[model samples]
Target: MICAPPEKIFRATRNRPALARERARLARAALADCRLCAHDCGVNRLAGETGLCHAGAEARFFSAQVEVSDELELMPTFSVALSGCDLRCDFCITGKESWNARAGLGFDSFQMAERAKLALQNGARTIMVLGGEPTIHLPSALEFVSLLPASAKLIWKTNAHGRTQARELLDGMFDVWLADFKFGNDACAQRLAKVSDYVRVVQENLLWADTHSELIVRHLLMPGHVECCWRPVAAWLAANLPGVKVNLRAGFWPAWHARRHGEFKNSLSVSENQFAFGLATELGLNLIP
Candidate 1:
């Protein structure tokens, strides 16, 4: 089934070309004093000053292809993964590309949108703008939206660590927010991803996204963090956002620098997966594929 009707979102009226351009303009100007993410490095990207993401004024992408690896309803999506990220997750599968700012081809919104159109014509269900974290490249992301067809189903797949300015720029742009709620508490977040106040930031973004667009929360069940991370995440979702689609992702592999951490040296075990699912069910989370 589809995520939701266009009218269900509060910003339906503003998801147009003009609005995209306006948002793009505002995001482009924000490069002078960046506050797009919680890091709030205040670095002038326009002057080549690098922030936590290390991304410059322009955006770069590592991968773009139509894939059937997302949620069932939103499969066959043209996933454009931008390079560089706000958080440095040691277990990131795509760390080779995600952590490097200049790892790929320069982004061309016009060309990429055309490619996405082709994918849509060739059985793709949605156009997904993901990243290392797209919040850092707001201008390019909004520019791509401006070039896309108004009726195209757009998905913003994010880490959900964005701040107020990023949310302001992204208010009504996408049809679905496929966000990650990787950690349930600040301690795990800081220890694993080197990001502080992670729970507060992600919850705030999820709340805003639920109001502005269709939100799908995904939490990758890690090997040793079932209780510390997944339990609290499920409990919060059950309490604050009952019936919200929760993708309890069971695929957690030890990739990248995962060997750096003792717990992340191996993938989740069968017992861990079962335990995580059992907990989600106990909390009454709306688990989807």
Candidate 2:
């Protein structure tokens, strides 16, 4: 099936200056006791305190480029790789660069807006905010989104473990959500990402995201986790969000500190990929090729 061209939601709200101001105000408030992600660090970012994500009041990003290797639905996209993350995934490809929020070149909302303009000129229809996790800097992200041109569709690529209150505050800003449903169970989550209640938090956020935006759930097929992670995630998606699209990714490779973990030390095998694909098909999931 041919996917439709990206639709811009910000156009309708562009005329409403008050709405934009209100959103900015609320986003700034969230920084007082940063409950942006599931970590709920509650650090006063405005007062120069850093949270678990290590992000401060200002927004920082490592790179901005036109990427063609994303999902087909969001191809020819302009991606902004933000700094800092709530989760410390053992296999993080970005390495320590993403972990240190202050390492990247800092950009205020105006600078990001200027970058978006250049991306749009280069024929990018989608503008994706990625990270360590973009939601960690909610106020800056929202401010940048507000400054963006209405021609490009906004896509937020996240860990899907953000606080519900933060998600509510960002209600009408995004057009699509590219979420990582990394682990299906809590034990793996705590062991891998150092987060508790992963399943519940991700599920609640996914349910909320599906209602507000076009949702695409991605699952990395990890070794020795087909039954524990893949099957359970597929079953849950089939039962609760049957219409949401799934991307059963087989691109896991030993990166960062993954070598220390026995399970994530190697790349996903062909057989493991096949099993995950077969499971998703059996569950009647709408998959993205």
Candidate 3:
């Protein structure tokens, strides 16, 4: 028999008290050796120490509440963007304000809480916490979400690297998990994202997601890197995590840091055939493009 869809199962999550308690517990943990995200910097952030992501005890970033309609599966989502990212995807298109952690600003936890409440008041039931990497500033992110009224839904956009430690921050509270499978090869991952162990981290996280929450994996098909980068990862997920939905994106503009980098300077997004043959035919999985 097939496992129920994460959305269907998650809709039944109503243990508000337990979720609240877990959130607080994670908040306290963040003050210690902050293993919030994969970086596991172990710095005493509560003392206002900055980690590699440059996020201190107080979270800093830019945000706007927008109703996401492009993602049909996650349609009508109210999203809050947290600035800063741990990995540097050379082909990133949204690097306008998030490219550099130094560029973002700080907001008090109370003020951030107010912004979340405002989003909810404006009919945003699902709070999509996106960032350079939400896991990097997880404590503040988790605390903010925990303080929200019990009626709000929590969502995240991540690179899926810090599964073992990151799962503790989650504690089965979030309703949705949107992750990116950047490169299939470790060499490519290290060259592109600067993380050599990305494959293992992403795989482990997806395994955890299979048991805990709804996971949607997105892959941007870069022209010269489709088969070598995106294909094997798709194959692995299809075989290991059969039920998770995969979004095969095709439009990868070599903007942002991509243009400056020779590897991506002239790279075109995946074409229709590449999506059909390379990703679709090989994986037999759902295609979002």
Candidate 4:
């Protein structure tokens, strides 16, 4: 659980919609010289120029549905999956849609917000803005936030690879930061997800998120990375963000380009799963089982 009362967040976020609108405006303006993600690709997306993420001037989404397949405390969430990502994780399960920014329907923030409001009315506990990595679609994401119900719990589900400008714009808007810590080091991150300076960027985002909002960290146990990936990740969490809610997920389905790497050719073994869980417990991490 998040260890926070819903009413406390509700009381504090009365001005969230207004603040999101202002941030949305700023985000759109930044598209002229984009620095949203850690890549710092200064492509002028406003002029049909593309960057590492390949996303253009508008936001697109492949899915928007209410689902309970999330952290227990934040279940029954209305998930809005934006279509593009900055990193190129070859084993991405949603690669067909996520790797290509132009793969989905163009977003209409007001319409999507209305749908999310209806979801809230129908018992959805949170409105989750996820991606491919929402930072790439900052303007639209913030615009969606600006239109959501002020009392609705909002979750920013991310890969934790955003830059300082994004963190500032997202500062006080989200109720929860459901982020992923995929790799423990830069070498593995570069080999697996094609991202550099990974550990520093993710840790910075996590530390800031922990201080700013209700944060939950999740690491999907890979078949051959128990020692090199999860071990260091768990150790860091136990040492730096002790007591933070962590979810050590064991399911690892090899999808998309997973076949390209030997380690990604199969599912996580029972031994790997057991070791990962045991290590998390031994590290005294507050795992949300």
Candidate 5:
């Protein structure tokens, strides 16, 4: 499943197929007893147990076509944010929306495909699949990608905590990977993302991305947590993955219980002068400045 060029995408979707019914079918089947994401809560979404992701059989979510402005090179990339994340990052910016998985509007697979179509119509060259962790709704996600024309390049933004599930989509389904290294150490990972094996899953999935598509690793610099938290993951990527691009995100706006409950109250955002960026430079990573 080599990623086809833009022209191919356009051509493939010249006469877009009607995908609503098939998407519905798959959604119903998957939600019957969902194992779509790594959490594998196995709760019957149709009965609406709302597993760890809080997503039910109904893919309720909010969507908008946004032009990502971070990467100058990818100037015209369109982004779609799906609601609900498996990990409740203390510094989550979209706390209002993603914290409880109840924030975003739910949409069917056809609706999602239309969003991608809208992105292309709006002059975007690529579509970014972001979420409450896209894997939360694996069947719908896969069906959405399958409906799109091959020429449309897809970039999946993930926590990289679900490599086995993520790997299932590696066969030419996605063109780029915009992944995150949320916790630098096991303790931080457990306390922060609530998953001690975060790094292990990410490392394995990253290797899969390296062989399959372009990989960009993003690390948010948390205040007072740089040395004890961000450095280990940064060093690991630099040594184990040389060509992968690194985005030392200076934006970690506090959200959720961060203002009072979590460890981020009165936290300061990272600037160009932050220490993490300097270490990334020293590590010889393909820094995204």
Candidate 6:
């Protein structure tokens, strides 16, 4: 028997203009203080002050393109790469430019909406919001999604370091959440991403998101850190988030500042990849290719 597809929550807001407007207002208000991400810089972005993420009052985007090479679940999509990252991971593939809010071309929500509409017209099925870490620009991201064509599903590629306020702003808006759970332990996170409370923040945020959205957890198996990261993450998911889909990625290439760290200077080995996949299988995770 063929099963019916799961409901897309954002469809409920398609015809509700007032709901969109209200959400836009709330997003803007949250941006004023700029406590959207885990950093909690509390910089008054409205007053032209910059925070740790370096984002000003407005949202900045590096690029938007039709990408065919994405997760199988989110293929043939229009991907929007927003600027500014909450965490500074050593092996960031997008490089320093994406993390730096000052570097990208700036655009307001309306402009982004227009661009998204164009992509939809050009045969893009999904609108993927990606970034240095899109959560850093929560307000603009929200506004952009609100403006998207209801026919296109919203896929959020996030670092899962979003604050509670950010979650509140995004509640009931996203169709799928692609959460990147980078580290399983606090020490590894502190060493790689310079975040001390990474474990708690990401876990809490992911658990919260699972309740409201179609959650897909992604873990990029880094070289020499599988025991510290992958195993713990798999264990946690098996115990706490059973039935949640996970993507065990083997594509880890040393890039950007990764060369600076001795352990991160090389790509994942074949053995390491096998071990990661085996661990996932042992844990009974619902893994996606």
lDDT score, candidate 4: 0.91
Question: Candidate 5's residue-wise lDDT over 1-289, tens digit each?
Answer: 8984442121223222234234435545766777655566778877878877777655445655667565655547777777777887666777656755667676666777787788798888887777767767666666677677766767877877663534653345566777888777778877766665666777887787776667778887777678876789878987898757788776667766666544576464444336777787788877875
* Local accuracy of candidate 4 as per-residue lDDT tens digits, 27-112: 99999999999999999999999999999999999999999989999989999999999999888889988899998899999999
Candidates 4 and 6 compared: the better one by lDDT is: 4
| Candidate 1 residue spans exceeding 4 A from truth | 1-11
For candidate 6, the 10 contiguous residues with the lowest summed lDDT are 8-17
Candidate with the larger lDDT of 2 and 5: 2
Q: Estimate each model's TM-score.
A: 0.95, 0.92, 0.85, 0.96, 0.82, 0.93
Clashing pairs in 2: none
Q: Per-model C-alpha lDDT, please?
A: 0.91, 0.83, 0.69, 0.91, 0.68, 0.82
Per-residue error (Å), model 4, residue 43:
1.1
State the lDDT of candidate 2 residue by residue for 1-289, as single tens digits: 9997564333324432345457777888879888888888888999999888888888889888889878997878888988888888888889686778886888677877788878888788888888989888777777787787654688889999899777877676777888999998999988888889999999999999887878889998888888899889999999999868898888887888887789876678889889889988888998996
Cα RMSD (angstroms) for every candidate in the order listed: 3.0, 3.3, 3.2, 2.8, 5.3, 2.4
Candidate 4, residue 263: Cα displacement in angstroms equals 1.1
Q: Against the true structure, candidate 6 has what lDDT?
A: 0.82
lDDT tens per residue, model 6, 1-289 = 9986674343434643345567767877777688988888888888888888888777788878889867787777888898878788878888776668876788577877787788878877888888888877776777776676665688889999988888887776777899998899999898888887999999998899888888889999999989999999999999999878899888898988898889886789889989999999999999986
* Global fold similarity of model 5 (TM-score): 0.82
Q: What is the Cα-based lDDT of residue 272 in candidate 6?
A: 90
- Candidate 5 local accuracy as lDDT? 0.68
- Model 1 lDDT tens row, 137-201: 99999999998888888899999999999998887788899999999899989988999999999
